[model samples]
Target: MQLPMKTNRITITKITADDLEAYEKLISFPQIAEGAGFNLISNKQMLGELAKRQIANDNTFGIRVHDQLVGAILLYEQIGQCGFPDEANLEISYFLDPELWNQGLMTEALEKLVEVFKQTSEVRTFNAEVFVDNVSSKALLGQVGFQQVSTVIDPLVGRKKLIYKLEL
Candidate 1:
């Protein structure tokens, strides 16, 4: 997947082994976990394992500014809701450095990434699920043309989630 998008002073590239360290640092932040409303990270060893798995398949990417990773984005298929690549509906998720909040970097990166996927991949529908309380994320999704299609609940977080779908 040789797609690296440059937009508004940032580049989004595929996740690699070299990116594990930066990813670990980002995941360790309290704001990252709180903003996303979930935590799949506990310690360095676990993060290393997860990064190794992600690197093996290259389904995700590191969002960078001046070659320093500040975030990541993923566009892949889901099993239960829709289907795989055959459905042409990809689940899109992203997280940025807390310090970069209110900077509009994510909106720029996402707009370009979606544009790239629209042209290069079989993706026709982009799915996004943001926690109800995440007003920033909800605004970003809306800014990128994603419409609220449904409301779902996360049993673990015990909060409502806004499900968005963007048709390209």
Candidate 2:
């Protein structure tokens, strides 16, 4: 589904294969990669492979501003091979160009996502994991009505992440 532009200058749309380059750059940033609790992409080949997999997923979306790819948001439908709440319980992950930090763009995009999710019958709640040190993301999630559930030590990144949940 095509989400309405939160700002007149920006458009939020579903992810496509053409977004590979932008996605690579967004995830390649050291800060972004570290904060996301993931290893940095070292080459275009790795990025290509990653993008291919992401594109095949039905839960990813791209966020663009003025026709330029700026970031992405992901909703995880399952954990490993186990089923959960179908689409009723969704986990959200997102990242923006560091240059766009503090501009309220992420908040705007998140608000738009919430608006769209509200219209879907299967989505009853939204969940997010914010790095304990990511103050900006915490604030944005709070602004969007997410309440802190708990903090968990992420073995993958060796950092504690605060889990937040929003009931729709």
Cα shift from native, residue 41, model 2 (Å): 5.8
Q: Write the per-residue lDDT of candidate 2 for residues 40-148, one digit (tens) a residue.
A: 5556687668777876687887889878889888888644346444666888999999999999888888888888778754688888998888899999999999999
Off by over 4 Å in 1: 35-44, 80-87
Per-model RMSD to reference: 2.2, 2.3
lDDT of each: 0.80, 0.81
Provide the global lDDT of candidate 2 against the true structure: 0.81
lDDT of 1: 0.80
Clashing pairs in 2: none
Position 86, candidate 1: lDDT:
48
How well does candidate 1 score on lDDT at residue 67? 92
Clashing pairs in model 1, backbone N/Cα/C closer than 3 A = none
> Which candidate's lDDT is highest?
2
